[model samples]
Target: MEIVQIFGFALVTLVFAVTLRQQKPEMALIVSLVAGAVIFLLMLRKIGAVVNVFNDLAARANVNLVYLGVVLKIVGIAYIADFGAQICRDAGEGALGAKIEFAAKILILVLAVPVVLAVLDTLMRIIE
Candidate 1:
């Protein structure tokens, strides 16, 4: 199964990283980054399937594609930010990682503003 394969790859990478960390720290970081990229690429297919499902459901519910796109963008930003932050942390830059996360939060809030306004407007109409 894919999960098993992923786990196996992760285990092997962990061991290799650990071994390299004792010798060449820079190369160890590089290996970690490459392994992370590989895993991310492997999961992209699954992510695509999920996006397709969301699109189908949105169509059935008559939801606007623009809103869906915005939501997806927010999610994408969150994931990418998290990945980057993790990488920074692994490279011993905790402060940088924290900054990345903070920026991501601000970006998510900005992206969500329109959706929040739409919901508030709908609620006001219902109460009127």
Candidate 2:
């Protein structure tokens, strides 16, 4: 039911944007941006509970939280980059969107270096 309503809202927004695209390009862009933001906000309402569950699991397992925090940060960066790219594309800047995604990939890789190095060191120790 809720999904249906979301689809309905998106459809309405799409039509609104399409109709306004020619006569009022600015309004159309605004409509698209607002629609994306609304959908993101709705999705974020679910993300909070997932974060809490992850935190609880890490605590119960007595695992260090630093890794969990890094994972969450990576996910956050990906989502933010995706949102920014989408917004740029909606505004007719596909090249800018691609650059945003490229930067995000680089940042993700940089942030992941520690994990990668740790895994490599562990593997070397096992081999030795």
Candidate 3:
């Protein structure tokens, strides 16, 4: 149901944007940006649902919440970075989009380092 609504909304927005793009490029961009925001807002519920599931699983597994927080941060960064890049690309700034993607990757790596170190430590202890 949500996917169907999303697709329908996107289709309508595209048609409108296409019609407006030739006469007014700025207006088309505005329309597109607004549509993107609305779609993202609509999908937040689903994202929250997934996060809840993961939280429950982590609780049952007795894993450290710090790792879960880090993972959620990474996922959040990925989504935000992708959204920003897409917006830049839509505005005809592919190079800027690429830079945003690179920054996102670096951030993700930095955020993941602590978890990676913890895992390595655990593995070394097991071997010893």
Best by TM-score: 3
- Angstrom error at residue 14, model 1: 1.1
**Model 1 RMSD vs true structure:** 0.9
Q: Would you give me the overall lDDT of model 2? A: 0.92
For residues 49-121, write the lDDT of model 3, one tens digit per residue: 9999999999999999899999999999999999999999998998999999999999999999999999999
What root-mean-square deviation over C-alphas does model 3 reach? 0.7
Q: Provide the overall lDDT of each model, using Cα atoms, as 2-decimal numbers.
A: 0.95, 0.92, 0.96
Backbone clashes per model, in order?
Answer: 0, 0, 0
Segments of candidate 1 deviating more than 4 angstroms: none
Over the stretch 72-124, how does candidate 1's per-residue lDDT look in tens digits?
Answer: 99999999999999999999999999999999999999999999999999999
**Per-residue lDDT tens digits of candidate 2, residues 1-128?**
77898899999999999999989989999998999899889989788989999999999999778878888889999999999998998888999999999999999999899888877998999999
Q: lDDT score, residue 70, model 1?
A: 91
Candidate 2 TM-score versus the reference: 0.89
Can you give the TM-score per candidate against the true fold? 0.96, 0.89, 0.97
Per-candidate alpha-carbon RMSD to the true structure? 0.9, 1.6, 0.7
